[model samples]
Target: MPDRVLVAYGTKNGSTAQIAEAVAEVLRKDGLDAEALPAGSVTAVEPYDAVVVGGGLYAGRWHKDARRFVRRHRRSLAGRPLWFFSSGPLDASASERDIPPVPGVRRAMTELDVIGHATFGGRLEEGAKGRMARMIVRSGRGGDFRDFTAVQAWADRVGQELTAAGRR
Candidate 1:
């Protein structure tokens, strides 16, 4: 709808990146031009009419890149639609339970007039993560808990919102 949409992500072990790509795909299918780029590559928000930022949650915190992106572009973001999502809750068994929002995310929402914020289950790869991440994954801390249906549903909602806003 906005002629261009940017889906930026900060991923650990690639799960969140995959999720960002999926969201971008769904947005494209909805007749919007969307691209999923790593947060580090995004120097500014000048090219997109809408922005969707996502990152994995670690120890109740979002990735640094994602946090920095929002902080750096807070002003630009305020003039446009912005959505945030965190990939966490790795315990698949806890999929049905209500996951709490990460503190950083909560603060971001309060400080910025974000349109929406969501928490999606994250993944824990066996050997892909760094020492700390792997240790956490191995210590029975998290599991592969992503729900595709829910992720797609959220993406669709974002697409609809962007479309409606474009019309206005």
Candidate 2:
């Protein structure tokens, strides 16, 4: 059977979830069994051969669900190939250059020995949750800055790595 991979994410306005789904789709196209799910909804990672976790950024921190998910599954995650991603930059910077993971995510990467990470631009539009979100949209600063091309390229690289590793 092909290796099973889990792409999980946490998001407030549903942008990060879209990124996770895209990653999972690429992995599936690459001949792996992959699924994207919400971080909070996942109870365990023991069944998957590899995992990808992602979260939306708010106030320089990952969403609480993502943080808690990592803490809760650290042991199992340590034993598997793991990757992380953050989606929260509200501009073109992510597509223009590589954005390093935030301090919190960096610490988790070190602790869990994650294989890779990427930062993608975020999306905020009308009907986004929370007062601050609404305020940002009203102020004309909210827009979708996510680059799906970059997202696909990253997932393709990840799929290559996983496929190569499985062969060995």
Candidate 3:
């Protein structure tokens, strides 16, 4: 199998895009051909060897783009190695960020038979959100809780596993 991977993300404030990029970079470093793309902009996943779909966890749901992407590509995804991630938990604990998947994401995961799923800490800065969003952030521990090291580690592990599986 070829080592091309797609890292697709649905991000409202671009933080998830940044995380996708980081995941791609780490995969590339591990010798996988990987590119990060916006879920809404992607019309097809057929070209990739594997896919990693991600989005922000907002209002107990994934961002619309990610959900829509899964809905559109459900059949194609079911035949391949797929991974899912959810970002955006203002809490300091990355462990605490492991919230359950929203209904849409859970459906996708169930249908696709995903290899794995992860939840990363989110970023919520002042002025980065709307009035209500900002207020919500203000009411919590507002900070950049993204853990890049863990992100890279996860990508590396995934890349290695992908390569190993390809050899089988």
Candidate 4:
């Protein structure tokens, strides 16, 4: 059997979830066994050899559940290869330089010793967000800024890492 990889994500409007699914697909395409699951639904980390956690950024913060998952299972996670990604910086002008680390993410990174981290752009649809989120989206502050090429490239790298780890 292929080595198992768990892709867990927290999403508000489903953008991050979709991204997680895409990442899982890429990994599976490379012959790795992968599954995309919600962060809240993940009760244990014992089934997987490697893990990828993703979350949507809201007001410069990762979703609380994503943070909690890492915290609650830090010990198990520390023993495995871990990767992290965030869906943020939705504006057209959003660039790596413009998007700094979110506070929760930064804190989790230190505790988890995450091996890789990425920031992907997110999407906001009309009439799909709460009043505050709508305001944030309407302020010309958000768009579907996801660059699929970059995301796929990162997945490829993760595949290579997983392959190398399996050989060891």
Candidate 5:
């Protein structure tokens, strides 16, 4: 059970960060104390009663910053409720199974005893992408795929769990 929750995310062009913030907003609306922050900037997990880590997924890989943050704080996050999320795939109809969490996430999810994981639709802006990413976007795989409704619903579910679990 956790009252103070940290919704941390790693993003290259800010899509994942925006989703994280929205998740925090939902959690706050649910009467929980929560904060949205860039994963790379978060140095400690001690202050948080729970943590939600998210990142932009690309080519079956999670963001390096998000991965690093989890690895560095794995011990600190051993308990107290933890979850992971990723934003990728251009189609909302596509199951998360089509674009699964990377190997690193699989390992951390198991080792950390993560409560759950979600994969949401992602957005790709041409100018924001790097060389390789831009190439992919140029090939016509870019648009706003974020489903806010889905995000809110997922947040609400997590918030309910946190609420029921009660403050630690």
Candidate 6:
């Protein structure tokens, strides 16, 4: 049987959710059974052989929902092959270089024994919620910085790793 992988994400303006979906798509194309869903909606992680959790970065921290999900599913997640991703750079920095996880995410990785992590660019376009988001958009600083090509590449690696492990 193919490995069942869950790609769960915490997103505010929905860009991170899109990223998660793309990741899941790549996994499926690579022959794994993968699905993407909001982190909060997931009631259990025990049914999956692996998990990928992602969140939008906010003020040097992960989205609250992502943090809570990790805390809630820590035990089950710790035993599985896990990966994490954060998207929240409104600039080209992420595409140009490696951006380490924020302090909290780094700590979570240690506690969970996560297999890998990636930081992708973020999106903050017009109509985004929050006063700060609005202001940024008005200031002309809001736009999509996510690189779908990079997202696909990373997911392919994840799929390859998982598929190889499963064959053992």
lDDT of 1 by residue, 1-168 (tens): 586999999887899999899999999998899999999889888889999999888777898888888888888888778888888776763357656557788888777778887788888867866888778767877567898788888899999998887788
lDDT measured at residue 77 in model 6 versus the true structure, 0 to 100: 96
- Candidate 2 residues 68-157, lDDT tens each? 999999999999999999999998999999999999999999999999999999999999999999999999999999999999999999
lDDT of each: 0.84, 0.95, 0.85, 0.84, 0.87, 0.95
TM-scores for all predictions? 0.91, 0.98, 0.92, 0.90, 0.92, 0.98
Q: How well does model 6 score by local distance difference test?
A: 0.95
In model 4, what lDDT does residue 22 have?
Answer: 91
Question: Per-residue lDDT tens digits of candidate 6, residues 25-66?
Answer: 999999999999999999999999999999999889998889
- Candidate 1 stretches with Cα past 4 Å from truth are 140-142
> So what's the TM-score on candidate 5?
0.92
As a TM-score, model 1 comes out at: 0.91
Error of 5 at 106 (Å): 1.6
Backbone clashes counted, model 1: 1
Superposing all C-alpha atoms, what RMSD in Å does each candidate have to the true structure? 1.7, 1.0, 1.7, 2.0, 2.0, 0.9
Task: Report the lDDT of model 2 for residue 128.
Answer: 95
Flag clash pairs in model 5: none
User: Model 3: C-alpha RMSD to truth?
Assistant: 1.7
lDDT of 1: 0.84
Supply candidate 1's per-residue lDDT for 129: 69
As a whole number from 0 to 100, the lDDT of residue 83 in candidate 2 is 96
Q: What lDDT would candidate 3 get against the real structure?
A: 0.85
